[model samples]
Target: MPKLETRLTRTFNLQYPILSAPMAFAAGGRLAAAVSRKGGLGIIGGGYGDPAWLEEQFALAQGVPVGVGFITWSLRKSPSMLTDVLKHRPVAVMLSFGDPRPFVDEIRAAGARIICQCQNMGHIMDAADIGADVIVAQGSEAGGHGAVRGTMTLVPEAADYIRATAPDSILVAAGGIADGRGLAAALMLGAEGVLMGTRFWASSDSLVHDGHRAALLEADGDGTIRTQVADIARQIAWPIEFTARIRQNAFTRRWHGHEDALRKEAATVGPIYRKGFAEGDAEQTGVFFGEAAGLIHSIESVDTLIEQINQQALDCLAGPATRLTSDRP
Candidate 1:
């Protein structure tokens, strides 16, 4: 594989400029460790903050250097979770879906890099203001919760903002990025690296259910829809601006546009949604994934996935120069 180095790699001492999104419930210790072992950074999803689950995942990492990510708004409910997790000495701590300022000082004091996932220019500015070590420009095309803005435009905009403001902060692109093509495109868009979710969610190392994995393989970009139905059904109480991009299923079909109705019926429907998710009923529950689902066809180990993505990105980055030279002759 060709060498692909960037500020992110240098700052993190990583061999690849790739980081796995800390997808809630799915990105566990095994997956994060596998990615770290494979040269990329893996982030265990700390999702709604079950202290026991978080501890268990960390144990699964077994001392490998890995980070942990959390839904920022959710993290507010359990401030102590951050203090507790800091004890494990994570390489980094990623915050998304809410203001990161409150916890920035603490994360920094703990000697861990602070990564803030931003959904728009406003969010980017806020992250920069808080002195985030890394800022991920998360587009709406990403799986899980995010606001409007496409990756292509958002990344460059964030890059410009960071250059003019927080020069020390590393910019990473996320959403609709599944393979080497996306990685190459991200770098060209002025980001130092890429943050992937759906691709890794489908990998063998991930804690994804078999049913969800099968659905992901069969899905196309069009199969995903950004909707509040999943959160509503699960009673997560995400902010108004954010919506989750998940595979459209029977449950979504019935509630996508009828969020108010779903909310009203949460007492009745919430249990069903939770049951479906627990049972791995693909059609009945939300299969959280992004537009990149179309790009994934198989479930491979994290090692194979990262190796292929790195090589392919290097090839893609070099293709234009090779073709231009050939044409000039």
Candidate 2:
């Protein structure tokens, strides 16, 4: 039982240096409250800015120090959505996948800390300039929409930049960190904590459908493909440069690189896709996950999972670096 104290845990008044990602549709009130109850920060996903869903989750959190997140660009479509969320006085607000400038001032004025997730140097610099309290270096290994940069390289780069520039801003690592080993490695890489999406997405408290969870359990890293296929097929208005990571099911295998084909046939395929999602057809719907899916074998409670990872990380940080260095002697 080693103490894993870092600026992040202290800054956020958390017992552990872990933060559950606000994954849209997957992370809800139960998941967020469960994580918060276990001493880790829980952020509810307000993905794509659904005011009703966001309000419902906030209420469900029931006075927990629960945070809320939004896809920055999508929130632009519904500007007042931020105000709606802000009135709740969330513990924190996370903005990702677009310019955070638009809402930075308001968030700061609201007296709540802001967490900005960035994929590249430019994005991070912008977050720093905006005075983000926590900067998450999200790699492409993360589920859902992401930018160019692997977690390994991006974490250190962001850490270095933060130290050099925004010394007060905390650095967090994201993408493919589903276990304790990854947590220890992130600490070594200069990050104060890790923002986990895929791991928490598979937790029992998560809102994942049984069918989608089945798909997630059956799949691994290779089982997912990063593409705008879902956006096109489901007719989501995502940015051209952005893409989502979803499990490779029959639907995706049928049209992996054929975006144009999916677009042309969206009229016919769209209904089926929507229906599959609605009916919980695992094969036809998108199951969002990251490369870390390969590392997750079972769905456990937030307390069990967070404690397991924390103790594992403590062991690694104290015992040896062998877990991170190599496999064979």
Candidate 3:
């Protein structure tokens, strides 16, 4: 057995330590089910806690043991929404971008594991205080709404923090993790596994447009830019401290520097944004991706991508240090 397989076989209840990050709009039933069926943990991005959309995706899952993830602060608006989702009995409840303390009891009472996504040590400690079963350290390289800390530093920092204070807690690294190299590096950085978004968003199962997937396949890391204007235009209020990483297009280029103006124009631009999504225009719509876009060459099936990553990780782990040379002996 390869060392990677041995090390990553059961990081959690998952057969593979790989996890598909809950990307709103892009990651839906097909993507989540595909990853879950392929031995990794899949999570439906319950973005803003839309019960209808979540219910539709749950039906689409068709018996796949998947969980649901939500934007924490957004869920705060409707506290009862959590209770509603809990009725479905998700494997876990993933909360990000806010204090997770308020809903911990409800999630626990429902017999669901709690996975908290954090941007820094402060939030990680807070999640630990809330008794999170798993803590996901989402670095700045991630797509969607994210903080400004880079993955290279955040993973190890989080790992060290947990080891010293809450050694029992499991840590997963997010942001810019696309390939086996990234996975191997994350493990080396002391993460038990990785939460991948950009890589999977380019996969065939993802709900994103073919043109968007194609663009992701061709884009290098430098092609992505982080901005808050898109969310503002959509009236998706996010904390000022966090920004969304998206493909830099004409719309982003125009508004990235002028958030106030974008807010003023949001009423008119909101419909335009939705229309752009329908029309598949990059300039008008937004495509989310992290720095890992540089590693994407083509969009493959979710299972194939998982296998490729797993094999690469195995090869990396079973290197010279673990190899036993029978011929030399």
- Give the top-scoring candidate (lDDT): 1
Taking all chains together, the TM-score of candidate 1 against the true structure is 0.96
Which is the winner by TM-score between candidate 1 and candidate 2?
1
Write out the backbone clash pairs for model 2: none
* CA lDDT scores, all candidates in order: 0.91, 0.88, 0.84
Q: Across residues 59-133, which tens digit of lDDT does each residue of candidate 1 receive?
A: 999999999998999999999999999999999999998999889889999999999999999999999999899
- Ranking by lDDT, best first? 1, 2, 3
Per-residue lDDT tens digits of candidate 3, residues 1-329? Answer: 23343233454456678889989988898898899898888889988778888888988998788888988999999887789878888888899999898899999999998999999888999987876888999999998789888899999999888888887678899999888777878998999888999989989898888878877776788988989877988898788888889998888888888989988989999999988876667777777888888888878899889888877776666686452211111
lDDT winner between 1 and 3, please give it: 1
> Candidate 3: where is the Cα deviation over 4 Å?
1-11, 320-329
Off by over 4 Å in 1: 320-329
TM-score of each: 0.96, 0.96, 0.93
- For candidate 2, write residues 203-254 as lDDT tens digits: 8899987777777778878888788888888888888777898888888888
Clashes of 3: 0
